[model samples]
Target: MSKFTLRFNTIAAALALSGLFATNLAVAEDIRVISSGGFAQAYKNLASAYEKSSSDKLISGWGPSMGTTTNAIPVRMARGENIDVVIMVGDSLDTLMKEGKLVAGSKVVLANSLIACAVKTGNAKPDISTVEGLKQAFLQARTVAYSDSASGEYIKHQLMKKLGIAEQMQGKAAQIPATPVGEIIAHGEADFGCQQRSELLPVAGIDIVGLLPQEVQLSTPFSAAIVSGSKVQKNAQALLDFLSSEKNAGVIAETGLEPVAAKK
Candidate 1:
């Protein structure tokens, strides 16, 4: 071939590549996400992998699924925060959807989180293998910390009542607001702490004792949904799909949660 023809062909190929790059850049989106502590670790793990493989980007924020705290997902939504996606407790997500805060038909269960107890690192691990043992542990703890979210609500009300220790745990067992229960225990502010296992695992300086006894165990569903009126609905749905995909189940399980298989 002639030298001019070869040069023209190379330039054409370069222009095509440049156009393709620009198209990708144009299609890329920044999906804003707010996740409660229970699913944060798993969402983070899977998000990293998704970002590496896709042109989309994820901007994450943390909060509790149901609380009046300033950073709580519901509070943020009420204040009109610009969030595209929300990962939180399944029941909370349903409530939000019913209230029209989240897009209907967008909810997807990502994992099932079990309530667990923890103590400061190097501290004695208490046996909570039986209903009686769990009651004894709570009774023995001088100061117990639980979350300000769902698990905490259960511990403060139902669990204590069920164990017939509600009166005894009155002032000593308190909900730690907007903070992980594990953090309170790690700081030695509380002798025992209880919260979702996934939330506990992310905090350093704490050793998870074990899950709550089967009879009193609370298996909370952690789920994701797109925020209502989000400008980037398509991108938000893509993120939800990535998070609930079967391929990422192992990652979610590694974070101390039981991954829920995505519905077909």
Candidate 2:
């Protein structure tokens, strides 16, 4: 072959190989996520922006931090489901790590939440400005509801006891399963609802009654963790890093969660 022909063929091969590599870099790979409703909107907004900014795609799953139902993150993990990352209540993530379900040292606080109350729209909002007022509101409502999530569990097992009205609410109160308490209230299935502020804000026709009194309210912190043996560890870590950054504070707050102090 002529020298020129040989050189031309070699250059073409190199260019083709480089083009293949570049195409691979531009295509985003899927990263799986399991997040509770408490912080679902924040992660969703961040994930959408992350996809636009780069080639890392997000495949998400929704579930509560703790529950026995199919949508519970812990239940899904225990059943051998595959996921790249988990966003859940902080203490629940700690429990999963202790049980060897998540990678050690992979947990990072994402945001803090307040357990808040809501009532149907166009209705007179209840008075929960004081501990006595909260208890009275609970007692006064004909039907009240809470979720099957961590916040619901807290209100059911702890807050009820604190208010000294647990027994009185037994028949009048309902425990909603894997659904937003705000949803139940909005539909008029329940006259009153209590859940994480983040969960409540997204539902329409529910008038937020504000956070419960400090004396009987819960300040729940949330976190994210890397799932063990995830197929997309590097990408998953990047997503976590973005969610935990201080720059995302405004978006996080818009979802009704308070951003924790950015890590040093």
lDDT of 2 at 220: 89
Which ten-residue region of model 2 has the weakest summed lDDT? 23-32
| 1-264: candidate 1 lDDT, tens digit per residue | 999999999999999999998976536689899999999988888887877767888998999988899999999999999999999998988999999999989998888989999989998888999999899999999999999998998898899999999999989999999978888998999989899998999899999999999999999999899988998898788888888888888888999999887334
- CA shift at 37, candidate 1, in angstroms? 0.2
Residue pair clashes in candidate 2:
none
lDDT of each: 0.90, 0.88
lDDT of 2 by residue, 53-172 (tens): 767878889999887999899899998987889999998899999998888888889899998999999999878999998998899999999988888899889999998999999998
Which candidate tops lDDT?
A: 1
